[model samples]
Target: MAFLDIDALVGLFPGQGGYRKGALASFWDEGDPVLRGVLAEIDEVALRVLGTDIGSQIFGPAAAIPEGPELFQLAVYTVSVATYELLRVREVEFGLLVGHSMGEFAALVAGGALTVAQGAEMLCHRIAATAGTSGGMLSLSCDVRRVEQILDLAAEPHVVVAVVNGRSQVVVSGPEQGLARIGAVADALGLPAVRLPAPAPFHNDLMSGVRTEVVKRLGRVRCAPTRTPVYSPILGRCYRGDDDLVDILGMHLVTPVRFDTTITRLHEAGARVFMEVGAGRTLTGLVKAAHPQVVILPALTEPAAVDTEDTDEPVDVPSPQPSTTDEEVMAQLRAIYAAALDYPEDVLTADAHLEAELGVDSVKRIQLLGRVGRHFGLEPSAVNGIADHETLGDIAGQVIASLEASGGR
Candidate 1:
């Protein structure tokens, strides 16, 4: 690849929720000093701060994704900094750097504000501080204006508009009840809404207290000015030498991530090429959604076959307008049943009966509910109750109702 002009290559460090085991296998296989040295420091920090060799949790094979949010954060931070180091050695000069949500720490490290170990330790501290919140995040496929309408529709809204990732995509985080209400309203408007299986409600008023804990836990660590211009979307500013790092990072948990605005500002500053400098293409896809004309790069997107497995992403039903058609909802439902039953999606129509037409009796439903419930993140009772509803549309209603009554995001 030809080197882009200086200050033209924008490094976009991703924040959270994209993890694949052994994502760094390719890098490790190269025995590159940059990757090796960064991971070594991070492992020491993990041992001192988190009491586990997260290196194994990160580099080893996985039967499952780590349920703990801390491991996920640490892994992403490690990969982002290591990848940036590799690029730096190859003489790929970054025109600018931006960290998305969790990716801020990585960017901070890459920009020389924090050492690799310091970044990992701080991230682990964040994962620990993020626990015990009463709510989770709900992702929506609508624009910011629609979110205000949804908030007004909910009686005594408890949720806060947390993230505006793309022009149309918004994520709200708050109490479970508030999220439930928001989800119901979004569904009625034909907007795609799904509760993220996140442990806590972050980037909202409820998280304000977490700031104190982060400052307290930062302990001996210190922040320096970045070698490269490091911009934070959550803070909506660039990190400076004299700025209070505590105030910036602490407030990150409480303030919404203005990713959309940050991207706009970055683009205005002449950052045309955006690179998701970590695992997963989530930020890549989001960047595309917001600005299709800009260049997007991935530091290490292709997973090595050595010890990684692919996971299915949640399917989104395309609805150009606010209201969902019966057909659109059925499309998503059909994909679910088809995957579990190993049947073609064409066979799973709205009017098809689970028992009479599809031959899914109570006994069969008991088996099918497991797979279906996992897909929707529903409880056994919720999934089993869905089986009682006959037609595909009826099952769809039950699923929506479950989302409405759900207390977890």
Candidate 2:
């Protein structure tokens, strides 16, 4: 049972529920206004815990949301102890299964029900379950019947009602024209409707006939059960260990997902630990928000501790006090540089260009500047001449000088 690296999972599933890194950062930074604040906090936690490892970089800060390393950690913690042993030894188990969506493939592969290559194929085929299907996902604070009325008004040639989330939120998908018509009706009714940040509309009548396509793909793949339990979102119950997965998997393409009920049933069935494996806190956060008593954790946040060579007792350096006014500013500059680089003061040079000398990239530069601004807790743009600074030390000097000029302690 070898432990699965979170980054490997990212490489495995590209452009699925979430974009890779480039899209991830933007999604957090600017993509969706609603996700910005939440993403920022998530990013902070990620950087602090994961450091600058391959998993974090590959997943990035934003796109990582759906299937981020954090979710993988959660799965590791909550899954069966035997599964943990397999992960420890890089072995596979076939008895473990997943709840729904592409996440199922990940769980199946991890459980050894499917080979890694088979999992990859299944995921690719699963994409067909929604590929090229034009429809929009709208979140509503109502149930399916009410949502259908909104869809009825839209009455476009291509509209399809999609997922039903929780008691209040329902997502609709169909042709954009139909969706637009629906939106107008929703507006007239004064009901809030927002489009989802997804590429394809899913789980509607539009996919009802797509089973042939899915069955063909599913047949080509070999499957087995380690007798792992699969909780069906559609049935609001668990499929018997020996239930026919092939048929159920095909039907899933067109079924309405009862995620809320399924989760509730899991708890009722005594599933104390709910680990949302793969990526994103989407499920875990929802689970935690819905059921705060449950323990929710993600794998990405379990960052490997910093590696050090010496085991000797560490020595603490005395705090150095400046002997003069200029020296005080210099000391502050050193502090600023250390904080900006997330490194030691000895590494930063006053004249060294931050980008060229310290090798800071665009993301790192923005993060550093953001940190500096927060540390000063003022309008960073107010520091007029500091933009021309070459290094962290220079920026620090300008910041301190401005603070002093403004009578800031």
Candidate 3:
């Protein structure tokens, strides 16, 4: 079926492990112009960096996708960008976009902060930056809370949660000893821990040196203001105009991504339609777990591979926050926004649009939020970290968090 959705659509870009050969078989067979153009732009940059175009590895009649980490990453980036372009050509009106781990590079391109060629260039630099680093990552089939227990059991200080994909998906990064300790603990706890064939520990303290190298190398490729409104789980906020793009992108090398929170935030922001515009269905599956009520689409019409797990237990889709405090928070937020906008509190419903229906612009939002911040004594960072202006409920959750956090202070 065609990916047709009128609701607020969210486009997801999955990272590293989301690649497979022949991902774009149908697109190539159909002679898609948009896909061709995107690949051409990336090949020009890839040829200069790797001495051969990435297109030669992913496309054409006789393509041999290399087993090396660098090549797999290149293919993932290329396929993701190309897939995004194909969707854009089809006029898929994505209301919000997000990237998982390294997939943020492609999201930046879609968000207009980076060009397609620049995304590919940054990926190549990323591959080069961590080539010499050591250690590995292990995926644990349990929630982050359970993973924390494993970490405590392991007593490996360097071990850290590198990626929280969903309720039951977590990947930790650390040195070999740290990883071994965690694995042993996980085995003891009866939780499955699969070690990745990662030559370098990603998004952990071990990447501290590599982070600086990334910033220096990508000094020429800073992300100029984003236009498409992208939320970064790694950064824990949307890309602000004043954000140090090069630095944030650099820091991501060592910063873990709270992707489960990203999905929850997007769902709060009035997004009920989602699609994974990449090479694998991993992001789609994670989205399904986070917001089971929302509609989700696969990576493409024909994907080379689909992500799977070997667990015996069935996946449990989590329900929304059932606490009475959450209901109170939403009601309190409606009153706050209603009073600020001079609208009747009854009309300031959860689904009320902040921009289209309420006529609140970004500038007006900043000014209004500044007043709310002073009135509630909310933290400046909390008021400023608003990711999107889609609905009152979207900003409500963040504001409520700020209120709760600053209540004691």
- Residue pairs in steric clash, candidate 1? 7-95, 15-102, 15-103, 190-324
The model with the greater lDDT, 1 or 2, is 1
Per-residue C-alpha lDDT of model 3 across residues 1-409, encoded as one tens digit per residue: 1222448678888777656667786777788888888888888987787677777776788766544767777787888888888777777767778898888989999888999988888887778888878798877767899999888877898999998877777889999888878877765665555555466888897898988888778886656788778889988777888887778888888889898888777766677788887765567667776666778765557634433311123212222232426566566566556555556678677776553235342323444555545544555455544433356777667766765665622
Ranking by TM-score: 1, 3, 2
List per-candidate RMSD values in Å.
10.3, 15.8, 18.5
lDDT of each: 0.68, 0.46, 0.71
Clashing pairs in 3: none
Please provide, for model 2 over 302-384, each residue's C-alpha lDDT reduced to its tens digit, 9 standing for 90 to 100.
Answer: 21111111112222322323222555555555665555445477766576545323434222343344445455543544332
> Model 1, residue 97: what's the lDDT?
80
Worst 10 residues of 2 by lDDT: 303-312
Task: Give the best candidate by TM-score.
Answer: 1
**TM-score, each model?**
0.72, 0.50, 0.71
Candidate 3 achieves a global lDDT of 0.71
Sum up the clashes in candidate 3: 0
Q: State the lDDT of candidate 1 residue by residue for 1-409, as single tens digits.
A: 2233534878888766544455667667667677889888988987877787666655545423444656767776877888788788888777668888778888888888988877888887877777665788877766888897789778635688888886666888998888877776765664556555466788888887777888788754667878888878876777778877766788888889988887667656555677767665566556665666777655644433111111234444332222434454457678766765556788777776454235342323434545456656776556645544657888777866775577322
